[model samples]
Target: MKNLNCKNCGGPMLIDPSGTTANCPFCGSKYVLDHRDTDYYRDFYERMRGFLHLSADGQERRRRADELWDSAASEVFECSDGRQIDIRSMHTYKNRIMTAYTARQNIIFRFDIGNEDKADRYRKNVSSIDYPSADTRSLSDFFPRISGGFELADATTLLVVKKREDEYPLRLFGTLSGRHTAWLIGRMENLCCVLEYNSIVHPEFGLDTLYIDPYDHQASLYGGWWSAVPNNTAVNGRICTTRDNLTALRETAAKVLGFESASAARETEDVPKPFADFLRSTPLSNAYEDFAYWDDVLIKSYGERRFINMETDDKQIYGKGQ
Candidate 1:
């Protein structure tokens, strides 16, 4: 995929959900595709849709071919004793506290200098999560599982966590349909309930911290554990509570619906009033109550629970020629 740049200011352009237009976030430049460009994107979208309609075995073969089409980039790091470790990564994510590299079956988080304690906190927080005995959902599997930790010779700390091969960062999907975002919100509500059950407040709970198995319609909290704390703990001169988690969920839903914030979400044919109201309304006292409220909204929004399969590929998600 080729990155699209703004012709006016030479800045990167963000493709709209319609895929025929783009906007430059840096320079406020807008671009509409020419006829030739539109035809190319139309053909690309058709091929992606055809791939999605393929049989399970056919999809598997295509996935294998995609793996061969894309190669992981490698980086070498030296240990204190002069030993070298090679990391082959397919994707990289950066936040204030750490830079994460997606290395097939594991995610390697390299914490900023002087933030080693946060790395330890991450491990402890994930390990402390508890689930009810009657919970057959295996909710714990979605949280991070610490594989190992290391101190590089460069003084940065690395925390290695295991992840499933099928899980990809939710942000990789870009903006999704309202139906897709609805299911994501339901999954997030389940996760928030678990956090509330343990009285944990995850400050950085949002799209960047989330992973999704689109094929299974499942979501996972795979990042931002370093910033997680117990409910009501004071952080940066403010109280953090379970409410923060619910709020983040709403914000994430709004983002996938192409809105800047929950308050900005408007009702449309696709995004019904109930769905918009859920995002805009204030969260209930705790995650339990909030989730129950969302359950009501979910039914009101779509009437009944049905798994809607959203078939998409990298080009359809990130954008054509990007």
Candidate 2:
């Protein structure tokens, strides 16, 4: 079976004899796997067990076969220069200025006619982000990386940005547990810190513009760059600052926890008082201060940092059973 970790402490967890429960050896935290989780882990273990029995050449062939299956659902488009481009996409998002397709390794944004300037700005804003020297994290990978720009035969502009294979839109998860959303909040705070460092204000920094890899507990900002502007820029007569990013982050966490807004978030069995209070509290003056404030709240709410894995497939999340 897959190795499970404690959600309350970063300790190794041992599966109970029942095969549907696990407990931490170090912290004594216990977890009962739901039906879906149990099934997922059982199937995963069987597949991995079978894979391990195969020879090296057999494993390599399986890897290539899986890659081919992933790219099997693709569409071919003609470029202005008579070159054909194949894009493997499973989801599409449409806004006023552009339509974005979630491809296998890239997000393809096709701008509407006469929106070339907005497309250019989208690329420029992401490219201009400068991280602080103290930042040892490879933060750039979490942001957009414009890999290709093309002119299609239909007269629309196409912009492609790299995306990690594990990353998926935050919307795909629907509602999550409080502890899970807390980690997402922490990730969003980290992203806001990067934006604050670059003096960039992303107006739409919520679920629609965010992506997450649940296995790694990593969040990425991959959309809405066209609306990004310098911090303190006037937007609809209101001055925008890094605080806006933090506020949006709270709202995002609230939404993921099944709340309409941060102000409406309240303490429940799953959500602790400190976590709810953080959601409803006013953000500090800047991202740095707000992040520091969040760290304190996190400790008060959860005691210590832990890595929790919420595993499932599309069937579990959006199947007829759901």
Pick by lDDT: which candidate is best? 1
Q: Which stretches of candidate 1 lie over 4 Å from their true place?
A: 1-55, 58-65, 68-71, 134-137, 307-322
> Per-residue lDDT tens digits of candidate 1, residues 91-189?
676655677887778889999888888898998898898886665349988889899888889998888989877676665555676666887898999
Alpha-carbon lDDT, every model: 0.76, 0.76
Number of clashes found in candidate 2: 0
lDDT of 2 at 210: 93
Model 2 ranges with Cα > 4 A deviation? 1-73, 307-322
State residue 158's C-alpha deviation in candidate 1, in Å: 1.1
Model 1: which ten-residue window has the lowest total lDDT?
313-322
Q: What TM-score would every model get versus the actual structure?
A: 0.79, 0.74
Candidate 2 residue lDDT tens string, 1-322: 2355678976556553224666665777888988986676455434322321233364564584365345335678789999999987755656567877877678899998989888899978987888887553598878998898999999889999898765766754556766667778889999999999889899989866898865567899999999999989999999998889988999889877778689999998778899999999999988989999999999998776754323443233223221
